[model samples]
Target: MDATLWKNSSFLKLWLAQLTANIGDQCYSFALLWYLLQATKSGTALSLLAIPEMAAGLMFYLTGGVLADRYSPRLLMAGTDAARIVVVISVGVMASFGVGQFGFFLAAQFLLGVFSSLFQPARTVALKSILPLELLGRANGILDTTFRSIRILAPMTIGLLAGSVPLSALFFANAASYLVSVFFVLTIRDSLKGKGGSTASKLTLGQYKRDIATGASELRHTRDLFYILLFGNLGYLVWLVTYNVGFPFLAERMDQGNGSTLAMLMGFYGIGNLLGSLYMARACYTRHLLVVLIGWMMQAAGFLLLTGGPAFHWLAFLGAALAGVGGPLIGIPSVTAIQVKATDANVGKVYAINMLMYTCCGMLSSCLGALWLGKLPVERLFLVSGLALVLLTVVGLAVEKRNHTTKHHSLDL
Candidate 1:
C-alpha cells in the first residue's frame, strides 16, 4: 500500500468527484425512499421505485462498456454528469410545481439510471488508469471507506431535515453535487492514457461483437475471476434486496419509520463499513479467496442477527454494523481481482459485464422480494438470506479446494 496515493492529483480529483456524487446519491435515495414509505407504506411501492433504474442498467450497461472502450472516459463521464444534473434538477423543479405524480418520478429515475449506467464503465476504467497496479487494493479500500463514511453523513443529514424540510430539496442538492463532480472530472488530464487495446478504431457492429466475444473469452478462461464474479456478488444481491425492502417494513412496523430512525439504522451500517474498509486498507492479505469466503459468512451472520433486530433494537443495530464490516471485505477484493485480471483493452468491457451482472441480480431480488413481501414474513426472508450466504460460502470453499487439488495434480503429472 503506497502512502503517497494523495500525490496523484488526477486520482485525487477523480476520487473527490466520486465522493461528492455518492453523497448526493445517498441523500436523494434517502429522501425519496422515506417519502415513498410515508406515502404508501407498501414494500411493493418501494421496490417498484428501483425497477426503472435497474431496467435502464440492464438495457444499456453493455453498450456503455462499448462506448468506454471506443471514446475518452473523461468525456463520457462529464457528458453523463451534465445530463444527470439537468435531469435531477428538472425533477426537483417539477416536484416543487406540484407535479408530484409517482409516474413522473419514475421517468426521472429512469433517466438518472441511464446516465448512471453509462458512467460506471468509464469510471472503473478511469480509476484503473490513474493508479498503479500494486496500489489497487489500498486505493479500492480507501475509496470504499470514504464512500461509506459519506453514506453515514448523508443519511444523518436527511434525518436531521426529515420533518423540517421538504423532500424535494434533497433532489436539488443532488443536482448540485453532480455539477461539482463534473468540474472535477474535467480537471482530470489522462482519460485516454489506458487506451492500448483499441485505439482509433471505428465501433462497427462487427467490431462490437468481437469485443464482446473477447471479453467473454477472457472471463471463461479466468476461472477464479469468473467464480468470484458469479458467486461473490450473490451476497451483494441478497444484502441489497433484503435490506432495502425489509428494513423499512420492519422499521415501520416498529413505529420507527421516520427519516431520523431510518437514518440511525443506515448510519450505523455505514460506520461498520467505514471501519472495515479502513482495516482492509492497512492490512495485506495474500489469500483473496479466503477473504471473500469469510466476508460472505460474516454477512450471513449479520442477516441472521437482523432477523431478531425488530424485537431488539440493539440487535438490529448490531446486525447493521456487522453487515457494514462485511461490505469492504467482499467488495474491495472482488474489484481488485477484476482489475488485476483484466488487460488494458478489455477492462472496460469486463467491468461493464460485472456491473451488468450485479444490476441484473439486484433487479431480480427487488422484484421477487417485493412479491414475496406479502406472503413471507420479513424475518423469514432474512433467515433465508443468512442461509443462502452460508450455502454460498460452503460452495465457494469446496470449489477452491477442488481447483487447488486439480492444479497440484496437474503439476505432479
Candidate 2:
C-alpha cells in the first residue's frame, strides 16, 4: 500500500494518455458551457447538457463492461477515442456555424457518452490488469490528484482563451487530445490476451445477458464494497448538481458577473482537490467507508456555512474549496476498494455496475438541477442540498459505527 505506481510502465503510458485527454476535455467543457451560457442565458441549458450523456452511459455501461471482458481493451480504448474525435469535431463544426441549438449538443453528448461508456470500463479493465491489489489505492490517488490538478488550471486557461479564441477551437483541441490518447493506448500490450479476445467473436447475446447478471451478482456478494460505492456516490450526486448548475448562476450574482470569476473560484476548489488527493496518495486507507463519510462531513460543514440567506461570493468560494478537498476522500478509496475486492474475471463487470449507478444518479441529478434551478434561488438550492447531505452522512456514520461494533462483515482494508 505504497505510492509506488510510478514504476509501472503500462499504467504510466495509460495515465499519460488520460492526462492529455482530460486536459482537453476540461477545456472543451468550460468553453461549451460558457458558450451555452451566453447563447441561451439559461442555467437549465448548462444543466441539461449532462442528461443525454448520463442516459447513454446508464444504458450502455454494463454492456460496455461485457465487451471489455470479451474483447481487447486496447482496441476498445483506441477505437472509442478515435470515434469520439469525430463526434466532438462534429459538435464543434455545428457550433462554429452558428447552430446554437441545444438539441444538437444533446445529440452530440449522447454520441460522446456512448463512446465514453465503452472507453471507461475498458480503461478500468486495463488499469486493474496492469497493477496489483496493493498499488490500487495509490494508483487511484495519483490519477485523481492529476485530474483534479487539471481542474485547477484548465479553467483559467479557458477563461483567458475565452474572448481571444473561438469556442470551436476548444472542441478541436479535445478531438486532437483524443487522437493522442489513441496513439498511446494503441501502444499498450493487450494483457488480457488469451483470455479476452481469444473468444470474443464467439460471444452471443445469451452470454452478454449472463455477463451482466454475473456482474450484478458479484457486486451484491461483495456487500461492503457495493454499499460503500452506493452511499459515497449518492453524496456526490448532490455536489454535481450544485457545483455544475449553481456555480454558474452564482457567478452571475457576483461582482464581475462573468465566467472568469467562476473559473477563478473553481480553480480554488481545484487547488483544494489537489491537496486532498496528494495527502490520500501518501496515506493508507484501511476503512474506505469511513473515509467517504469523512469527506461528506467536510462538505456538509462547508455547505452549511452558507448563511442560509445571501449568496456571498467569499463564502461561496470558501465552501467550494472545502467541498473540493472532500472529493478525493470519497473517490479514491471507493475505487480502490472495488478493485481490491472484485475478482479479475468480473472486475470489468463490477466496475461497469459502479458506472451504471453513477450514470443513473447523474441522469437524475441533471433533471433535478435543471428543474430546481428555475424554481428556487441558487443559494437556497445549495443550502437545502447541503442540509440533506449532512443528514445522509450522519445516518451513514451511525450505521457504520454500529456495523463495526457488530463485526458484521467489517472490511479491513
Candidate 3:
C-alpha cells in the first residue's frame, strides 16, 4: 500500500489522459445543458438529450466488453479516442455554423456514448495490466483524485466562460482534449493480449454468446461480490437522482442563478472528493469492502441532513461534501475488488457487467426523478431516498457480517 506505486509511467500517462478527457467532459456537459435550456426551455427537451446516450451505452457496453477481452486495449483506447475526437469536432463545426439541431446533438451524444462504452472497459482492464497488484489501490486513488480535481475546476470555469464564448468553443476544446488523450494513450507501452485462447482463432457469434453467458453465471455465483456490486449501483442511482434531478430544483427553490450556484456546489463536492481520495491514498487498511459500506451510511446521513428542515439549510454544503466522500470510497474499492478477484480471462466481461449495472441505475434514477418532479418537493424526495439508502446499507452490512462469520466458523470446523 505504498503511495509511490502510482509513480509508474504507464499509470501516469493513463491517469493524465483520463483527467484531461474528464475535464473536457464536465465542461461540455454544462455547456450543452445551458445551450439546450436557452434554446428549448423545456424539461422534456433537456431530458431527451440523455436518452440517446443512455440507450447507446446500454446497447453497446457488453459488446464493448467482449471486444476488450478479444483485442489489444492500447489499440482500443487509441481508436476510441480518435473516434471521439471526430464526433466532437463535427459538433463544434455544426454549432459554429448555427446548424446544430437538437437531433444532430443527440446523434453526436449517441455516437460518443458508443465509442465511450468500448473505451472505458478497455481502459479499466488496461490499467490493471499495467500496474502491479499491490499498487492497484494507490493507482485507483490517484486516478480518482485527478478526475475529481478536474471536475472541481471544469464546471465553474465553463459556466464563467460560456456566456462570453460560443458553445462551439467548448466543443472544440473537448475535441482537442480527446486528441491529446489519444497521444498520451499511444505513449503507454503496455498492451492487452486476448484472454480467449488464440487471437488468431475467431469465435462464431454463438461461441461468443456462450462465453458471455458463462461469465455472467460466474458473476451470479459470487454472492458477496454481487451484493457489493448491487449496492454500488444503488448508490449511483441515489447520487444521480439527487444530483441531476433534485439539485437543479433545489437551486431554483433557493433562487440561485442559473448554472453559477450549481457549478459552485459541484466544485465544493469535488473538493470533498479530492480530500477524501487523498485520505484514502494514505490509508493503511485493506478492509475497503467494509469502508464502502460505511461510506454509504455516511452518504445516507448526509442526505437525511439535507432533507431534515430549515435548520439543515446551512448544512447543504456539508451534505454535498459527505456525499462526495462516499463516492471514491465505494467506486475505488469496488473496482479494485473486481480487478483483483476476476480471472484475467473474464476481466473485461466482469467490468462491462459492472459498468452496465451502474449505468442502468443512473438511467433508472433519472427516469424516476423525472416522474417525481412537480409531484413533490425536492427536499422530501431527498428525505425518502436518503432513508431508503440507510436501510439498504444496514441490511447489506448485516448480510456481509453474517457471511463473514459463517465462513470463519466453517474454517474453524
TM-score of each: 0.86, 0.86, 0.90
lDDT of 1 by residue, 95-134 (tens): 5665646787788899988998889888877888888777
Q: Which residue pairs collide in model 1, if any?
A: none
Better of 2 and 3 by lDDT: 2
Full-model lDDT for every candidate: 0.80, 0.80, 0.77
Question: What TM-score number comes out for model 2?
Answer: 0.86
Candidate 3: tens digits of C-alpha lDDT, residues 20-105: 88888886788677777876777788878878878888998888777777777887888999998899888778767877378888
lDDT of 1: 0.80
For every candidate, C-alpha RMSD to the true structure in Å: 3.4, 3.5, 2.8
Q: Which has the greatest TM-score?
A: 3
- Residue-wise C-alpha lDDT for candidate 2, range 181-218, written one tens digit per residue: 99888887676334447666677888888888888888
Winner by TM-score between candidate 3 and candidate 1:
3
In model 3, the runs with Cα more than 4 Å from the true position are 1-3, 37-43, 159-166, 192-200, 252-265, 409-413
The TM-score-based order of candidates, best leading, equals: 3, 1, 2
Q: Which ten residues in a row have the lowest lDDT in candidate 3?
A: 192-201
